[model samples]
Target chain A: MTDEAVPSWEEVAHRYGRTIYNFAYRLTGHRDDALDLSQEVLLRVRKGLRSYQPGSFEGWLWRITRNAFIDETRRRKRRPTVPLPDDDRSPLGVAPGADEALAAMRLDDDIQAALLALPIEFREAVVLCDVVGLTYDEIAAAAGVPVGTVRSRIHRGRSMMRARLS
Target chain B: MTHPGDLLSALLDGELTPEEIGAVSEHLDMCAACRAELEATAAARTALRSLPVLDPPPGLLPGTAPVPRRRMLRPVWGWVAAGAAALALSMGLVLGTAAGPAPMNLDGFSEQHTARILVQPGVQAVRAVVEAP
Candidate 1:
């Protein structure tokens, strides 16, 4: 074992649970999918914590979250039951909206819709920087991309939304 | 003041160094383009932050374990378990056959061996060569 302390899964969950859930919800735009994604991230964290080097917990956790989202996206793509653009829609797409009650979340539907309009790559970068609140280098590290790429994505993502938001 | 251009973004996120911030700040004083972009990014960031953070449904976290899990057998394990059972049954049958007539096996073409088999049959004549030719 490394000299660094090992945080129990309970502790990690208690600490980052809301953050991870929010990240997934913001990324997927569907509460059920968000739940699934957060649970997946937590499960992965529990299992992979032994291998975690006790550094950059945020980076590691976010990486797992991103990867899980990618896998889910690919799985959905293989057998899409509905026409869902890469717009953070659920696997069943907009149909679930009919059954779902208006949630008590303070999320602005307009902003969430605007965010979903962005391309996935740029959206991930912007969300990591602004919503997920990672520093540029941390976002880059978590995304497994160069700092320069992170910079570019943030710039483009914000610019696109900026044009549309105004 | 020069054009901060895209550096407005880096400055908005506080990613800029002291010197870079100074430069961008000076540029933003006169550059309407940079100012507009900066305002937009800030607005988008604010809007995103305003999006609510919802608590995950119960048991999705660590301490609250979900009660119901699909206890179905995994396909690979199912195949392995089935294969093991089949192997065990086949081995049992083979061993059972081998052990069934083990006591009745003939050590040689002896009179005793022949009498044992002819007990339920018509009188069968059999003789063993007592003298070697």
Candidate 2:
């Protein structure tokens, strides 16, 4: 009934699909779980779009993504799987003659590990901000928290990761 | 001088208001400790952002242009057709088997034909003649 412009499901999938996948990947740290959550979110988006009022589409989509992730997490009856710390074989965490690509890959693994180690709340806030690139207000809307809380969580989340990485 | 605390992160993210940005900027200019904290926070934020944006498994989202038209359409109707064909084949086998003669129960012919004998001996005799094998 609303006259506001709404994107078709195909548009949403094409435009935001990568972001949603990365968001879930950063949150869950498992590729399969991320894929599952993305599909679930897309399905929800398709269903919800029928009744969706024109508003912050990003927020609505992220909220559905986040909810689907949480539901899946709960249904699995276990915590998110944490990757093991980098092995000592490389000793320096990088091997001689390794290319920049390998070095970057190792660094990425460390960062992903740090992300997985964070508490779920802070992790969500940080991923939504840095990875998903949502504004504080949008993140607040999606998270059902205040802007101040979002700010604090992002700050604390970064501090924790910094300490862990250091 | 009071530190901006979490506002430093807000400033890094460009989330602060103009006035807040001004205040935080002023603090950053004067406060070496806060500057250090800001640098570390920015490092973490950069690392998070630098983690590669992974692509979803190909063809994960249906009707997305990245997928070829044929691949997407194939699985659906292909599955339906395969399933329907299997179902039809199985149904045909079942109907054909039912229509064809059942293995004759030679062990207990009298018991098997007892109902027929009591109901219609004449019909059983005709069937016996027609079904001799």
Candidate 3:
């Protein structure tokens, strides 16, 4: 879409803010850090919009989001560690029939916990592949890796998750 | 028994070619181990899909008002201001030295004068004469 055709930042914020925020939160497991990371990602997306080619806006946005998270992780590594307090309030609380629905579909708390336990590389692969529903190629582009690497990582990651859950 | 670990992962990932799929299917008929692996992977992937799309904390969107550009620019301006002040002080030293006193070849005067020149603005203008043989 042309720059004009694209939704205004405010509109985009209104529409996709929660999605990006949740993605960051799940990736970071810290609300404050997730907020900061998501804001930074959006800021980069805004500045870099002109350069973004016309195609797969979601993919492009996700790439920016992924990079932003990686950069924040690196920055946090250099700084003194201040542990984020646990505030595990799921905005979408466990709903009625969720367990059964998830069972039929296969999503359970154990799976999520297993996912969280994977290494960052594996976790990211699983999140993008399974949770985000991105194609291997899209995940590779977003992750700045080869498609083969993405496939292998996703394979190994899923395998590890299965082992953990089992 | 077919090694379902390899084929199941490939199948789950949609990485298998049509021919590989046919081969896998044939193998699955004869191998209970491979069948079990396929079932497990399917169950796991299905479970993964059921994960609720988490809502990120408030205010994260592509078009959201950025950490105000002005806020980011503040540090840049501060650096510019500090640089400008340093330049002004240096210029003052050079100009002050040029406007004031002739240098004499005395030990204490040289040391004290050097210190005094450093403290004074516009002292650089006097540097040439002070160094002359």
Among these predictions, the greatest DockQ belongs to: 2
DockQ for each candidate? 0.28, 0.30, 0.26
Tens digits of lDDT, candidate 1, A1-166: 1337678788888888888888888788777778888888888989998787877667777888888888888888897856334443332234435644234121366677778789988888888888789999988888889887888888888778767766
Best by TM-score: 2
Highest lDDT against the true fold, candidate:
2
The alpha-carbon deviation from the true structure for residue A47 of candidate 3, after best TM-score superposition, in angstroms, is 1.2
RMSD each, Å:
21.0, 17.3, 18.5
Residue-level lDDT tens digits of model 2 in A1-166: 1246698988888888888898987887777677778889889999998998897677788889888877887877676555444332332345667798687877888998899999988999999999988899988998899999999999999999999999
DockQ of 2: 0.30
* Model 2, runs deviating above 4 Å: A1-3, A78-98, B63-133
| Per-model CA lDDT versus the true structure | 0.73, 0.81, 0.70
Question: What is the TM-score ranking, best to worst?
Answer: 2, 1, 3
* Candidate 3 structure lDDT: 0.70
**Candidate 1 regions off by >4 Å?**
A1-3, A83-107, B1-3, B65-133
Q: Which pairs, if any, clash in model 2?
A: none
User: Which lDDT tens digits does candidate 3 get at residues B1-133?
Assistant: 3464555766877878899888888889898877877777777677777666666543354333335432212245655664675697778753446558645436543544455565565566677679888
Model 1 lDDT per residue over B20-53, tens place: 8887878778778777778887887777776655
